[model samples]
Target: MLEHAFVDQDGLHDFVFGGDGLSSRYDCLVITSQRAVEAVGAVLARAPSAAARARVLAMPAYTVGPATAALLASVGFSNVLGAGDAGNGSVLADIIVADATRQGALRCIFFPGRVRKDVLPQKLRAAAAVECDERVVYESRGVEGADAALRAALDAAGGAAQRAAPRAARTWVVFFAPGGADAAAATVAGRRLPAAAIGPTSAEFLAARGVRAAAVAAKPDPASLLAAIAAADAHDV
Candidate 1:
């Protein structure tokens, strides 16, 4: 049985591809979220000609996880990388650096939400031969009431102690992105609820806000995230 309850999150937004056209010569495409893939598809639909769309599709696409890679495949991206093993942005950056080392001077175009962290770009730029262009495909609005939901969850967890629920002492906030963490950090300040980050980027963002995640799941699956949280809960006990 799942020991955790999800806090309510609101205000998800649709995004559009930011670039007017493929202005720069890029060797590969970097896409992180499935939403970004959808945005790119929208851009392709408006392309001047079929050849234009074909050109973008021909470039090797590096995705953060298998889900993103699969979406790229549906959109006609034949050459895909980082679909397996490299589960998070940091690891994907490492894979790109290694692959680029063999190919020499890689030019990368990144499609990400505007609320993203700089870890991926920073790592890519650190390699002297790699240049990354960020195209903000969408804007993400931080949802309010995450802190309030968390507080309510904590209160509920405490009440469950009368029934001796196994998770009474184990309250954690799961953050999928930096935007959510950024929005809720202030309101939840001083509460210090153990947080579980979906990936390294969220963990780093939470850490910078002085709220270090007690558990961080780098893998891009629900089972992996649950396992991370369970292990952390075990350690806390």
Candidate 2:
């Protein structure tokens, strides 16, 4: 099983956009992560007037997961829509596309991190009925001293680097996104530590780094990812 040994916290180093044109031009907004929600909340906190805050909050918000939707509600978003079963960028895109087509909504503003998958925006751009205005509200950087932390975590977790680790005592690192691949690979340099990717893009990313993922989740959700890992474990057994 994989834990903090292969990854670490993604800290939001900067918050970029304040709620500028969001209230007037866009009928709906797209938000992907909890960090993006926090960025929006910060902007709303600094809004000049209640009217400005209300205007921004009144617009319907489409988000990646239920957690994000709940955060939107807490931050005064009146209409919050979320990806129903799958919490990923692609599913969020589908939800946006369907809603845009049904409601005849045109202008959309996406509040996302600097390092995110392009699928939602790309799909929105490709759709005929929608025009997405992407705004970078935040930038995230990997935590400093993460590589050392990963090594420490592995060392604490029964020495994955042990040369005589049993054949059955396989070690795997599960990557939730492609961003963590390089650092994780470097930490497990000489070990045959298998990997499980959250989706195809991450799996491909790992593959490019000369590490093949033993499991690739069909959808980017916890259940699917865990299921993929369980299936892989079964196959190897």
Candidate 3:
């Protein structure tokens, strides 16, 4: 079983749709997460003219993976490409580079959250050698502490004992982001528990705190997360 120790806090403010050195159209629009897609959608929905929406919809949208791509589709983006199975910035950068090479030099507009790795833009520039512009649409913040539900579950599970004997316990903590890893680490204190990470970056964060990830998901999606949990459980068995 997997337990969520942290909740997401929306850090979106100061919306800038156009202007400020941003172009209305680009060769590609990159969205790193579902939150970024939603943030961009909110800005586009407030456009004064229908043509503005249409222009954005017509642009080629690239995402970290299926989840973000699905969110982009829901927001009326016509063409969306997912970064295959691995939902990481590096993988997405590769795909973007390949596309740009096939179509010649391209301009890219990135809608990324505040707490994002510089890997995407850096890799895109180096690989594709294109002009990339980043617009900070939203920010991701971690909850200060564990919620009531998580606290109650930890109390019921006998805290340290449950973590000490992973083979006898099926409960595991899943971290989806670095912020979540930090918050969960503070909440759990020094109790060693089986942990799973959504990607390599999150896994590294947890590893820094002395919590070795039992499994790391290939992509940051529900199905991939479940697969990671299953792999962790297999080790217990």
TM-score top scorer: 3
Candidate 2 residue lDDT tens string, 99-165: 7899886788887766577788999999988999876766655677888888777665546446544
Task: Give the least accurate 10-residue stretch of model 2, judged by summed lDDT.
Answer: 5-14
Q: Mark the regions of model 2 whose C-alpha exceeds 4 Å error after superposition.
A: 1-21, 152-171, 182-185, 188-190, 199-201, 216-224
- Candidate 3 Cα deviation (angstroms), residue 187: 2.8
**lDDT over C-alpha atoms for residue 17 of model 2:** 24
lDDT of 3 by residue, 18-47 (tens): 542123446778887777777777767766
Query: What order do you get sorting by lDDT, best first?
Result: 1, 2, 3
The TM-score measured for candidate 2 stands at 0.74
Against the reference, the lDDT scores of all candidates come to 0.73, 0.71, 0.70
**Deviation of model 1 at 67, angstroms:** 2.6
Q: Among all windows of ten consecutive residues in candidate 1, which has the lowest summed lDDT?
A: 1-10
